[model samples]
Structure formats: structure tokens, C-alpha cells
Target chain A: MANVIPPRSGTAFTLARGQRLTVIDPCGEQVADLVAFRADDIDEVISSGRTIDYASRIFLTTGDPLYSNRSNVLLEIVEDTVGRHDFLLTPCSADTFRIIYGDKEPHRGCFGNLAHALKPYGIPPDRIPVAFNVFMNVEVDGSSGAIAVRPPLSRAGDRIVFEAKLDLIIGLTACSALQSNNHAFKPIHYEISS
Target chain B: MANVIPPRSGTAFTLARGQRLTVIDPCGEQVADLVAFRADDIDEVISSGRTIDYASRIFLTTGDPLYSNRSNVLLEIVEDTVGRHDFLLTPCSADTFRIIYGDKEPHRGCFGNLAHALKPYGIPPDRIPVAFNVFMNVEVDGSSGAIAVRPPLSRAGDRIVFEAKLDLIIGLTACSALQSNNHAFKPIHYEISS
Candidate 1:
């Protein structure tokens, strides 16, 4: 069955090996934090450093492999309607809000949502790793090494698809960036199919 | 009950808030990869960048607070027999073996051990985060920005203790460095008490 993750919340599910999971930004401008783990073992998870090293690319697109720390291929991107997915950036957390916006009040973010969604399965908040930010616009200036966050370029109905390399448990969070003034945050749609 | 994590293996357990968890280097030369997640949420995990930014020190000692990505205090080092714990380094993974030693063969490492230990709890391999290396001797050269790995200075009963700031699920892995020629690997002892 397909799932519709509400804006600013998260969801978790198991996708069998060879099955494909597609994430859709139904109304565009929303960022989704995508994370995955091997169904058989949670510890040998996707490592951004390793993935960048192996793929020889910082920005992932179709055909790119998401690698685990154990050197295992966990997922392969098969389709991308938005080509600018970021695997290098860590997900926004409460600290991100405090540091960037000087907002000390606890706010909803991808980190918290992922934690809450996985709590039922015994995964705690601290176990959440850095995730792939899909449909989020983050640009780095080469000269200054400065990063700028912008509105996603994807239009409504845009999606990214990945073929699972192993039986996997996936987590998705409608990012907290919804609170930002630059973009409109909207609900995300997902499907896992063989 | 207390646990003895075998060399090159890992185990997971929950430590309630205010509880203390001590990691003992029974044979002195071994290193342990310590990772924690807030027991209630898995996404707001330990971040080396945040911890370093908050502590203002790269090497951890008693009184240093390990900060999560959300800027929350996850653990406070309350006691230490060796003051050189490193929360900055990512755990040695299978890729480490392949890159440094050129060994394409699958080797036992902390990443694998953690994934195996947490499997029953439903954490997948992609969820393991960067870990705090307890008793691992990693020295950084300031002038050249180079790093060197050395045998730990801890003695046969050296240990470090942390008071949980939040209820937590902690994972400890006997590091893969046990296979390195510079040091001998041995079992690590752990205890959780009020």
C-alpha cells in the first residue's frame, strides 16, 4: 500500500530487496529527508562520506549508488525528476533552528519526526543519521565555500525513485524547512512496489 | 545485568536518564566505539560537529557535554581514567579496511558489529551514526593537519563514565583496529548503574 506522509511529520516502512520506493513532492517546494537501513542489520547504514568517496560525486542523481559503511550498496537511484538531491548536507534539527534563526523554542524538524516515527521499532532519537535531502535547494559557492538554501526547483508531482539493494527499512520526514519563508511546505506521497 | 562486549563485536542496551554507564578497557590497548540515541527518539543523535562546537575541545574529558544534532545534551562525561576519548572520528568500517590496507575481503569492524547487535531492535544498517571512540589513540598534528593512530595509553583497568542526560539506547562496538599491528585487541567491559 502507498503512504502519504503529512507535512512536518515522518513515516517508516520496510521495502523488500528489488522493490522500488518513490518519493513525491506532491505540491512542490517541500524537502524530504530520506534515510534507509538494511532490514537484516541496522548498524551497517548509509554513510555520506563513504557514498561520496565511492560514487565520486557530491550530488546524487539517477544511477548513483547509496553505500553503507560496510561497503554494501544499499540503494541505487533509478529515477529523478529533480536532479539536485543533496546527500552531503545533514538534516535540519532543533539546533539548526536555534543556530540559524536564533529560535530557542523547540520546533518540529526532520530529525524529531524521524525519531518519533521509528520509536515504535525501538530506534531512539540519537540513532538517526544524516539523511538525503530530496528536492531541497542547497547551493555552494566555490570561491567563498558558502552555502545558500533556496526553494526547490521541482514542480508539483516531481519524484525520485530508488531500487533497494537489500531488504530495507526506510524513513522519510517532511522537512521542517516548511517554516522557512522561502518555500511553501506541502505533504509528500510515497509508494513501494516491486 | 552488566555486559561484556566481545572483541570485534558489539551490543546494544538502554540506559535510563541520570544513570551512569562506564566503559572499561579490560586489557588496556583495545578501543571501544560508543554511540548513543535519546531513548525516546532516534533522530536527534550525537553529532561530532555539534559536540566539538559546544565543548570547544576536540578531545573529551570529564565534564564535557556530548551534544546532539538538536543541541540537546545527550551525555556528560562524569569520570575518566584516560582523558583522550575521541567523539570526532567515525567508526572504522569495512571501507576503512579496503582503503587503508587494500584488503578487498570482508573484515569485521565496529560498523558490522553494531548493525548485527541492533538487528533485533529493528534498526537497519543505514542508521548507525558517527561514534565516540573511547580509548582510541588518534593524534592530530596541528602544523600539517595530519593525523596519526597510536596504541592507547590506558592501562589494564582504565575506564570512562558518562551520566545520561536523557534516557538513551547505547551501542558499543569492539573496534576493528584490534586487527591493526600497532595494538592488541581485547574484550571491553561495561556497567550501567544509578
Candidate 2:
């Protein structure tokens, strides 16, 4: 059964090694932020540095491996329809909406959502690292080193799949930021296959 | 008088709002990693995302404001001799040497050194975010999103200066990674001016 993560919300769960996790963008242009931690030891979490350093590229896709802070492989991309995802940016937080969007009343963004969702597993807010932002469009200017967040290219029903290489605790979010979701928040769907 | 941080070491201290910090590469080609946290609240730390978003560029220099996660300015570059500094890479760790350099007896790199130095201040390992890498040369291939580490462009006696926007707890390191410092290790110098 497909699990539905509602708009501006998130969920957390565990996956055994070799399990296939598929994240679906039920609606076009919505973004999902995903994070993983070693099930046995929470300290050994997913690392954007290790992942990008080994992959030699920022935009990861099929066949790419997700690396942990300890330099261990945790997940591998088995399928990807949308090749563009962001690992450089941190998941949007309450500060994001206030600082960038000038929202007087800030929304507890994806970071907040992920923190709450993963708290039961004893993961604290500071334990969160940069997430692999799925279905998010970020344009980086190479020469100037400038970054821009654009609407995702994913169409409705676009999905990406990952095969876990280690027992892991995963956090997934239907991102709450306005600019990240093209100013419209929507739900996300995901499923696990043994 | 400047405080000398010995090779492959780190230190942590506090700075008042409006104070100035000068980090010096006393030996050319050495890299230093720097991080700042709000004195009033440790939860509000220096954010590469907020800094890059506001600066609109990765190679930050004089006049660029270092932003906190809360979207507030924490530091501003008041002076810079070597303009290129990396806000993207995390502080190198014991795992970094083991994973990238294949060192069996890994030296505790900047990350480990900073962790030890800041332990007394109530910051756990997980709270540490990406440090501003000073005097390190990182070549980013924009189109492919590839990154390469190169020797620092800074010469002996080169320096970068920052003015604090808020009272801060600052972490400073003389990076231990062999690659970031051109296969050599050297000391760092810093001084605070009111």
C-alpha cells in the first residue's frame, strides 16, 4: 500500500537492507525532502559531502550511491524519472519562510516537520543534515556560483526509487516552503517493496 | 597579539556583537575552517543556506554578510585579501581521511578537533553545521556540479576579516586534511578587535 504524506507534513519509518523505497510526486511541481540515518547508530547519518564527493556530481540519478558520514553506502538509486534534485541546500525551516519569504507568521517548514516525525526515534532537530530534495528544481550558475530555486520539472505521478544498502531510519516530507513548491503545497506518496 | 592555533588543531571562544575577527594564514597554502553560533541561543547557528541565499554567490568576500539559520546577519566580511572561500564543504573529519585519503590511522581533522574544542560550551557533535572554509581552493565545474580541491591561493600573511553582527561563539580550526592544505599542515592566527 502506498503511504500518503499530506501537504506541509512528514513521516518517519525504518527499512531493512535491500528494501526498495519509491517516492511519488502525486501532483506536479511538489517537492519532497528525504533523510536517512543508520538504524543501529543514529550518529552515522547520511552525508551530502560524502555522497557528492564520491559521485563527483551534484545532480544524482540512477546508479548513484548515497553515502553516510562514516563513508559507508546506505542507499543506491535504482530508478529516477526526474534527474534534478538538490543536496546542497538544507531542508526549509521556520527561519526560511521568515528570512527569505518575509512571512511574519512563519510556517514550520520541512525541517520542522522532519524533526517532529523523527523525534520518536530519538532523533533531535540538530541531528538533521542537508536532505536530498526530490523533485526540486535548483538552477546553479557555474561561472558566478549563484543558485536559484525553480519549480520542479516532475509531472504528476513522477516517481524515483532507491534500494537501501543498510538498515536505516528514513524521514520524508511533503515540503512546506512556498517557493520550493511553486507556491502551492501538495501531498506526496511513497511505497516500500521488499 | 594574535592567538596561534597550532597545526591540525582548533579552538572555540566568544565574541561580542560589533567586534572584529581576523583570521590569518601565517603560512601560505594552509586552510582554516570557521564557524559561528549565536551567544544567546545555540539553536540559531551559522547557515550556509541563508548566507548563500542572501549573498547570491558562493565565493564570499568583503561586504558579504554571513547569515544565521534564522535569517539574521551574524558576521559580515569587512576585509578580505584572498577573496575565495568555500561555504559549501563541511569540516573534514576522521572519516574524511579514512574515506577519501585511505588513511588507516586517521588524524582527527577539523570536524573532530572542533568537536573537542567546543564540547565545554554545550554543543554536541550533531549541532555542528558546515564551516566557512578559509584559504582553501575548491574548483566547481558549474555545468556538471563537480567539485575539486586545490591548493590555497593565499600567500603567507594573507588574511580575511569579519565583523560580528551578534554576540557569538566562534569555532576556529587549522584544517588537518592533507588535501585541503596542499599536502602539508601549518598553524593559523586569529585576533579579535573591539
Query: Each candidate: how many clashes?
Result: 17, 0
* C-alpha lDDT values of all predictions: 0.74, 0.88
Q: Evaluated on chain B only, what are the TM-scores of all the candidate structures, in order?
A: 0.94, 0.98
lDDT string for model 2 (B1-194, tens) is 89999999999999999999999999899999999999878888887766776665777898999987666899999999998888877788877877788889988889899999889889877667778898888878876777888899999999999999999999999999887888889999999999
Model 2 misplaced regions, further than 4 Å? B39-43, B70-72
Which residue pairs show backbone clashes in model 2? Answer: none
The candidate scoring highest on lDDT is 2
Worst 10 residues of 2 chain B by lDDT: B49-58
Error of 2 at A182 (Å): 3.4
Work out candidate 2's RMSD over C-alphas. 2.4
What RMSD does each model have against the real structure? 8.0, 2.4
